[model samples]
Target: MRVSRAETTMNYVLLLGFAAFALAPVITILVTAVSAPLGESGGIHLGNFARAWTIGGFGRTLGNSAVVAVIVVTTATALSILAGYAFGTMHFRGATVLFYLFLLGMMIPAEATIIPLFFDLRTLGLTDTYLAIALPQVAQSIAFGTFWLRAQFRALPVSLIEAAALDGAGPLRALVQILVPASRPAIVTMVVLVFMWTWNEFLIALIMAPGGRLRTAPLGLANFQGQYTAETALLAAGAVIVALPTVILFLLLQRHFIRGMLEGVAK
Candidate 1:
């Protein structure tokens, strides 16, 4: 008993250390955001945040980011869950090969695809539009989401699905009422992962939505830095604001994510 107690304490101590390491930079950014003035003032001020907020145009940028993240998360979650079920629970012609092909997108680096995506969007008149950013992110989400959800779906007992079918539940019905509810952890994990990815996504937003007017938070923050020029504190505040949503999302969903990864994948 003493040994077990000692082990648990040590584990917690280690976890706290890891937590600090992860949070240090985030805390630093928060500190910086409130600490200094735009230029020669070099002292703490609340105005830094306000100044960054107004000048950075973060309100519009944050709104744009919120829209994209929400849409991408919902669209990707639904599509990925459906596709994952198809690939995992219901085998169709070319399904295996197609899933692997989707997985191949993971191998191809983002840099390789950005140029082609730009040209394609330019032709389609999607440049500087939310669709321009959202569509590419949707596609990118599939690569990872499919892989993750397929694993979750594949882990379910065949008996559960078969039992539902026997009870007059159609495939769609069973998927919604049975498969999905049973796979809550996996779904939560997928949502969190998708939200975080879409929220933090920088390069695609930068390339696809270059207009300062249409910029997302990260892009807006970058531009804010240039616009303020020497206001490290304000810049840091903007950075913190941009990062907050992702942090809250991860905290909310992290438990389910880890559980799904461990237990859901095992099945």
Candidate 2:
């Protein structure tokens, strides 16, 4: 049935409201980054952003965030894609139990496990390193990423695999050649999700690297707040610098992302 005009109108209204709600803060942040001048400025001073960059130690924090996010996304995607393919397509005993164990990560709060992780990291002397921040994100990301990609992998016709086998192609060959190419949409979806989460992650960064030992961008932003109350412009600039990459990534990959979601939902 066609949607009623009244329903469409209501939907549009709700959509506009949501759009405004979501964008208002982003606009505020960007505007403030340029003009609000978070601290020590009589009014709006664009110089505030540069000051925040230096004083807040944004350079180090940004580098730390970059390294951690890059490592997490790469490891998470590689492991999840491989495991997802196996779990979704190949048959095996104990798979169900293992998948359930993986699901347990979802139920447990990241916060709840931080203390134990801290002790574990302390023992290994990995604390304050990019590895410490990245490993947990990888582990946390894998479960859902695996589950998501498994469905994508499974959606392919088994006949493809059978045909590849008839042609003397091994399982790995078929997966690498045929399955992976066909599943790019889903992989892009996972990439976007993981990157965004890892980029914006604050708590893990906070616990893993305090005192700007290895500050991430979010931590830098927070530290910026403490150092400058009047240089809001600088804060805004830093935030924009931090935010734009993710937004650009989303824009470039959104079509594949939508297709992946639609296909997953249909399956």
Candidate 3:
């Protein structure tokens, strides 16, 4: 059925309205970040970012977040690819039970387990370190990645796998050389999501790295907000700094991300 011109116009209007609603706060923040702080008179205050960076110690915190994101994304994606392939293609005893166990990670809330997790990490003497922050997120990411990639793998034609096997390709070879390349969009989507979650994670970093030495970007931004409560420009700048990486990553991978999400939904 063809949509009427009035309906098309109405849809465009609704979409534009939603787009503005979503972007208004971001635009306001960007404007505030560059504007002169209250009781000051000047042009664009680019120096607020520098001041925020120094006072917030964002150099260290951003570095820490980057490290954690890398560790979580790399480890979770690799493990999830292998696990998803197994779960999607292979049949074994207890496979259903094991898959549901992985799904349990998704069912459970982080808040429910964070306190116990902290104590467990403390007992192991892993607290106040990068592993303390990265490890939990890696586990969480793997659960989600496995669920996502499994569907992607299952949606592929079985003939591809059969063809690879007929050509004397082993499972590992088939995965690395054939399936992985075919599932690039899904893999990229998982990586982007995992990186964003790991980068923005605050409670885990706050609880695990209590010493503040390994504070992630979001954690540092919270601390910066506390100290600069009256410095609106500086606070806005810090918020932007913390959010910029995820925004950049999303923009760069938006095509693959959107395609993967659509495909996943269709599958």
List per-prediction Cα lDDT, in the order shown: 0.85, 0.84, 0.93
RMSD of 1: 2.4
Task: Report the Cα lDDT for residue 219, model 1.
Answer: 86
List where candidate 2 sits over 4 angstroms from the true fold.
2-10, 36-48
Best by TM-score: 3
Worst 10 residues of 2 by lDDT: 36-45
Ranking by TM-score: 3, 1, 2
Error of 2 at 166 (Å): 1.6
Q: How many clashing pairs per prediction, in order?
A: 1, 14, 0
How would the candidate models be sorted by lDDT, starting from the highest? 3, 1, 2
Model 3 residue pairs with clashes: none
RMSD of 3: 0.9
For candidate 1, the 10 contiguous residues with the lowest summed lDDT are: 36-45
Q: What is candidate 1's lDDT per residue for 153-256, written digit by digit as tens? A: 88889999999989999999999999999999988988887888888889999899767566888888878877876767878888877888888887888888
Model 2 RMSD in angstroms = 2.5
How does residue 13 of candidate 1 score in lDDT? 100
lDDT of 2 by residue, 104-163 (tens): 777788999988897898789988888888988999899889888888888889999999
